[model samples]
Target chain A: MTTRTVARRVLTLVVRGRGAQGGVWGEAVLREFDETVTTWQALRWAAGGIRVAMRERRRRAADARRAGARWRRVSRRIVIGSATAAAVLAVLNQFVVTIAYEPSAGMQPTLRAGSRIIVDRISLHFGGLSRGDLVQISLPTPAGRISAFKRVVGLPGDQISCRDGFLIRNGVRVDEPYLPAGSTIDCRALTVPAHEVYVLGDNRAASADSRIWGPVAERDITGRVLVFS
Target chain B: MPRRPDTSPQTLLLFRALLADPSQWRYGYDLSRETALASGTLYPILIRLADREFLETRWEPPEQPGRPPRHVYRLTDAGADHARERLAAAAKPSASSKKAATAPTPRLLGGAR
Candidate 1:
């Protein structure tokens, strides 16, 4: 191709590719004298340009470093700000259930008889309770057994009972799918109280839930379990 | 090209290795095998170094016309300087060592405290 044609082609390529104008022109300058510049030639120019740029950058960086007093002051303020934020978050997590402990065998098999769990207590902050959600209630007493971990079997005034080892709710046999095989219950014919729940365990034979202590008041409910964690 | 202050140990090691021949681009698997770093760890550092302008990365077009590309990394001018500094720093011991060597020692009281 002719020199003018090649220049036009290169110009068109530069426009189409939208390359770095400085670097591309630097390469173009090499191409003007010869059809193609070897990788070494291009690299040599790049190295020289980079060395100059680096020197300038280093000078600017040194000036910034000399103004360390201002940067130190800003950094200290930022550190203090972050520490305060972390402290606030720690306090918030304590109230919102960062961890949970299984006090008894009330909701066994699924959550184990006495397994300690780290509850994501924030789950209930956005979403409400659902049936079959094993919940932990935060009580005022420091009895070391303040939280009651149990599965929710009934809602407010949701008629619930046991019939022939089957959970009967609202005149229909509520399916207890998670319950272990050959488990039985004799606690039958009970109406869930107002603002109270009819709770039970998958291990009906060895649970100390509503059957023993009666229904729990809604005010006692702390938060619903999102996961075993 | 800006100097990349690499905080990660893996990145510091990688920069030192690349300083030997920076223009010769190294592949991911080769770097991973040579550095003994997991693929997950190596790839992230490569990307982070590239982001900080310490390294330049490119995907080598596959030998076949329509095949997955392989990534390659090379040290930029800024990366080379930073790597040299890091290497020099690694070679030198801290000023604290001298104080430790000459500091007064406390004698044991009753052979126990």
Candidate 2:
């Protein structure tokens, strides 16, 4: 095609991009192309018209966005976003998993004071309690109830006792590997009742557990410490 | 109001060209040739001027056959006054420079041209 025809088509496109108000300006640009000394200059002029079309399009878009802006539109988005996040966290906190801070040094050597732990709430409900499982359960306190982290030393109908600085479960000498060497425990032998578990802290010397408070009901176990962690 | 008139060097050149023929309605190409501004740069400035009611525009039929009508532009009275004010402000820095050469303390100039 000839440069004149090509330039005319391009100028037409630029005018269309500019929309209604730009049609007049587009005419001015198109008419001036014929006055140029050469076809090349006409093409260049048409090319330059593209810039005007682009600028007009951008300006119109910005103006439309500004005109349609309202507080309700922006505020609704924020509200919905926050509500969705809170609801998801709530479900995760209730059933899937929960974040807990290890409060005191009762479970020392394993969990330090002020350490953070992820408790798997779903596992305890799905998988039955096993011996040596670290579990979080609520224990009665003077004011109300308090959560405690301890290792289950005895399960339902099992005999448990601390003797000669070692743990004995079901008449078998169970090595207390997690505890500090030479740690001593002198608790009497006790058979864990049905639907209950006997628990103790890894720091046997410093813990107040089943030896002093007796067995914890299986239903009272809140969650298990994540095995992966 | 349509905001302040553009006072860039190129825009000032356009203002001067228009002021040179304030009474005559001139075609876009004629003004572009006089001011040496490309059509792309020229049209947007004219649109802004028209939007601000600083320039008036019209359509004039081509004298020959098989030719489209031409867009002709002339500055309004307000545009002429604005162009004059801006031109005078632009000249003040040079005028002040000559005064500074004779004065003991240097005086700060006003807004940028």
For lDDT, the strongest prediction is 2
Native interface contacts retained, candidate 2: 0.61
Look at candidate 2 and tell me the lDDT of residue A120.
89
Report the CAPRI category for model 1: incorrect
Error of 1 at B19 (Å): 62
lDDT on C-alpha atoms for all candidate structures: 0.62, 0.80
Query: After superposition, which runs of candidate 1 have C-alpha atoms over 4 Å from their true positions?
Result: A1-95, A122-126, A138-145, B1-113
Residues A111-187, candidate 2, lDDT per residue (tens digit)?
A: 99887898888767767899889999888868887898999989989998766767888889887788877777878
**TM-scores of chain A across candidates:** 0.53, 0.57
- Shares of reference contacts reproduced by the candidates, in order, are 0.00, 0.61
| Each prediction's DockQ against the real complex | 0.02, 0.46
Lowest lDDT sum, 10 consecutive residues, model 1 chain A, at A24-33
Q: Name the top TM-score candidate.
A: 2
**Compared with the real two-chain complex, what DockQ does model 1 have?**
0.02
